[model samples]
Target: MSSDNWTEQDVPDQRGRVAIVTGANTGLGFETARTLAARGAKVVLAVRDAGKGKQAAARIAGDVTVQTLDLTSLDSVRSAAAELREAHPRIDLLINNAGVMYTPKRTTADGFELQFGTNHLGHFALTGLLLDRLLPVPGSRVVTVSSTGHRIRAAIHFDDLQWERAYSRTGAYGQSKLANLMFTYALQRRLARHSTTVATAAHPGVSNTELIRNTPAPLRLPVTWLAPLLTQKPEMGALPTLRAATDPAANGGDYYGPGGMGELRGTPKRVASSPASHDEAVQERLWTVSEELTGVTFPVE
Candidate 1:
């Protein structure tokens, strides 16, 4: 397979590997979990709904289990992490593939902006809690799924991180996605010393998935009109993430996405993010703030 055109078929064997895929019940997360399990990985569907997770597991053909995880609640996050720690002594892949997009203004159980809480903070705490399991394992990776939206109306918003005053759905979603990339960079930097587990990020481009159910009416019109040109199916969308998780050439802090025009759709390949996503100071600041918010500290460094 060409490095520039990697596909699911190119995913190496996953036998004996234990992978935890958040939101594995549907969309990109589901596709990602299914592919990994099919490749002989012992996959855990870390979903919000245990019933839906079991339903999804029933459809896959390999070692698959379900774990309930609600990203909006810190209590649930901690509970799920504890359960996962007990079940899996080591984790080969931790895919933070769950997220919300363009959601209405709302707060999480912890009173943080919904998108930011679920998309970044939840995953941050989970990774920190589980870092020890991956540290000793060679080739272990933490793959967080970011988005092209990270570049649109995205900022750290340190002044009012929770969107207390006002909120733009798109802006909040963008900030969350940008934070995902920054988290990966910051974590990878810390993991560099360990030299075993690495953190990577990926985007699905614009794939046709249920994640778009919350698109505001105005944006929905354009997306619907250009759906043919802008969107690919969920299977294609899962490729970038799969590549980022499994590619032997992949390095810490590398990002993967569609290799096509405007990065809207195409084969999976190494991709670049906005300059804002690469700001080291911002990455460190976000990491610090995330730790403060989640109350979970990484064992790294």
Candidate 2:
């Protein structure tokens, strides 16, 4: 989309919808939840910290619910999912919004690398586990928040996905974000082939968010100074995601991001990806590997 295209007011009617926004306590996630709720959707703030999430929702000025969801733990994922299923019964939208970046090497409670485990695997399992309920409610959508880092950090080291052999915080972060996009595209293709639920991805162009709190001082110094000049506010970056989740014109497999300065910061825009990302083989492999790792197959058929 052009920079001068549709504005936030262009967001479509979202009444009667129920959205589950992971990490809805702050950053882009919080803005997403707030927008959805204000638009009349019952937004559920799924976060790791219930207290913080409650406070965030309380400030949203809309219908918002607080729910605990720690993406680093499969057991936590399962429990939170079960709670949502039991309580809401159906979820019309799922915003895979939580993520970690440039952190010290660590593993999730499930033993997988922290970045991939939480950003990709957790959402993989959560979406698959909740598939039944989501499918029952027609026109449901799953929006995975991704990033431009995929361009800098291509290639999935299947041999050592945990990065025990080699680890660079930036590289690991990029790989994880790429996996989010790959999963989004692959899942959308799978759904088109055999199902109806739509899958889409978006990136908040260098938005100032807490995802970078743990970033190295060297990296943070430049980012801290450059963000205000180059990055859009979290609310602005959240617009593309909101569009993906609510707009009926949003097609499955389409990607949205900033259109200005190499997609770094601008109004919401639909963009393309590298050829490697578009490779069908890689996406299928990633999908199969994800299913095996999570032990939760998304039966799109």
Candidate 3:
């Protein structure tokens, strides 16, 4: 992400580091996992589908394990974390990269809006539960993959955080993405006050991934044909997150993404969050709501 020349070979040897990539079976997640594993990190693929997860792990050219993790369900999230902790006590990287985008309103098994629940709350819970392990590991990091969509709806409606009253898929996605950035910012602050874990965020910039298959055909065409022009490949998209994780100089709370037109697609560059995302009050409120909703506590706990 630092430059287009950055490659997996540039990463230092990480033979002892243990890393986890949520939704690591495809797209940017897959590339992140593959590169991490290739770099000698003990990589775990936290995926929702077992079959696909195994397939993904198999495709990676390094040591990797695939575990079932459905972020939308607290039960699934807890079970996966418990299963992971039973075997691996040290974690070096936690990539909150699995996400759903612009889904037509659908309720999760827990009866929450799908996009927000899966994209943010699931990760919120997973990271909280794993803090015990992450905090103990030396030089550990947490990478939250956010988006430029955050510039759209940075508002946190305390009373209606789930988009129940007014539902716009795009609006909800934007809100969730902003929540990701806000969470990343607040998390880094909290970690600074408590643990050594660094929390950073990344954006894939219109990468061609299965993440967009659910969209309408018309909407998919332009992206499919023009993504090479406007979007970086999934491998390119993963670099920003990878750089944040492995780069010696990358800092906590620094958001990385493509450096191309309007920040759409190119090599990774350190970028600023919208002024709205800089609101400490809103971040604190969102953190409180997330904890209450996910039943996971952070530094205070």
Candidate 4:
């Protein structure tokens, strides 16, 4: 299948596979889970709100279950991982899809910036905790969802990662998204030896999702006005992630995004990230700091 024409219809059979998708209550996450479940995967909606998770599950067909997961809290992440480990034994796909966009200055339960803590650290810990199960399962994949925002004024603020000195909502979001890509690259290198598991990434490309609620007013107005014309629907936005998770041709370290101009919206295809995201030194440093912050380590070397 050509990259420019990939769509959900191209996703292969996933019978007997188990996929855990975070923040599956609404928007792109929900759509991703729905599509996977429809294709015969046992889907677990790991969400912060059990009620919402159940509601989301009810709307989907096939084997669908909900698990409580609060990424802002490390305790919640640990508990969710334990529950998942006991239930599935082996996860075929772990989609790190939950995220927070531009938000007012805030900290996670661990005092880290909300965007970095929840979007990157939370998934970091969850993946590390569950990686053992994935290692032995051939073709198992860890798909982390990043964003084009990583290319827009984004850098890993090694010194003030918590944004203790100053804060810019968009910048923080970019850092978190960039961290997602860095995590994928670093993890793929570690998983190379195992060869059974792989790590990949995807970006929704300017989708109309609930994630936009926190956009700054100045930018929010124009985005709201042009959203219908410029943004893709949540289902379309989820195509990149779904393809990354299930595409037979996708490889470890490959990234999927919209193939349209500016990557705003189109069919899912292999895409390139910003040059900064490919920096090996920064990727390694972020991985080490993430280990220290999350206190979770994978079994892989």
Residue-level lDDT tens digits of model 1 in 26-64: 999999999999899999999999999999999999999
Top candidate, metric lDDT: 4
* TM-score of predicted structure 2: 0.96
Superposed by TM-score, candidate 2 places the C-alpha of residue 216 at a distance from the truth, in angstroms, of 2.7
Off by over 4 Å in 3: 1-5, 216-218
Q: For every model shown, what is its TM-score relative to the native structure?
A: 0.99, 0.96, 0.95, 0.99
Candidate-wise lDDT, in order: 0.94, 0.85, 0.85, 0.95
Q: Could you tell me which 10 consecutive residues in candidate 3 have the lowest summed lDDT? A: 1-10
Off by over 4 Å in 1: none
The sequence of per-residue lDDT tens digits that candidate 4 reaches over residues 1-301 is 6667987888889999999999999999999999999999999999999999999999999899999999999999999999999999989999999999999999999998999999999999999999998998988999999999999889999999999999999999999999999999999999998767999999999999999999998998999999998899999999999999999888999999999999999999999999999999999999999999999998996
Stretch of 10 with least lDDT, candidate 4: 1-10
- Per-residue lDDT of 1-301 in model 3, one digit per residue for the tens? 3255566566777788999999999999999998889889999999999899999888888789988999989999999989988878888999999999878888777877888899889999999888778897778999999888888755676777788898877778888898898999999998888887889998877787887876646677876777667766788889888887888777889888877778777777777779998899999999989999888897533
lDDT, candidate 4, equals 0.95
What are the per-model numbers of colliding residue pairs?
0, 1, 0, 0
**How big is the positional error of residue 42 in model 3, measured in Å on the Cα after superposition?**
0.4
